[model samples]
Target: MATVIFTKNLERHLSCPSQQVSGTTVREALDNAFSDNDQLKSYVLDDQGRLRKHMLIAVDGSTISDRIHLSDSVNEQSEIYILQALSGG
Candidate 1:
């Protein structure tokens, strides 16, 4: 099971209080996490279910390019990190 870690900014809406979760891929875990906290779905993804422009997902330290396809497979030992990108001058 892949372990998903959410940034502090995302902790508020998480149903499970832990910083990490277990799943087989970035998408599956995110789906499970969002299912538990539907309110957070809109915050993390766009109306098209794509990673919002301000959000990013990395697997085992490698950035994911297909935000629309969150079902990308991940290994049990992989570490998934979800964070919001800050934009400004």
Candidate 2:
């Protein structure tokens, strides 16, 4: 079971109260999170189910490079965080 922490922006759309989740891989964890909050799915991913350009995923504080194939192995103690990247000056 991996623990996933979402930013305040994401929490507002999620049905679950806690930010933690349990899954074997990144995709599974994200899927579970989205299941509880389908509204957020489109915001973080595109129509093709690929990570949007403005979204970023970090595992244990490290950014992931494989956005399309977000199948990283997760552990019971792993921490996953999804954030919407800010842009424009």
Give the whole-model CA lDDT for all candidates, comma-separated.
Answer: 0.75, 0.78
After superposition on all C-alphas, the RMSD of every candidate to the true structure, in Å, is: 2.4, 2.1
Worst 10 residues of 1 by lDDT: 13-22
How many clashing pairs per prediction, in order?
A: 0, 0
**Residue 41 local lDDT, model 1:** 77
Q: What residue pairs clash in candidate 1, if any at all?
A: none
Model 1 CA deviation exceeding 4 Å by range: 12-16, 19-23
Candidate 2: stretches off by over 4 Å:
12-17
Clashes of 2: 0
lDDT tens readout by residue for model 2, 1-89: 77777677866765434456778878888888787566788888788878899988888888877789787777788888888788998
TM-score of each: 0.77, 0.80
Worst 10 residues of 2 by lDDT: 10-19
- lDDT tens string, model 1, 1-89? 66777787767655434335567767777886677676677888888878888888888788887888787777778777888888899
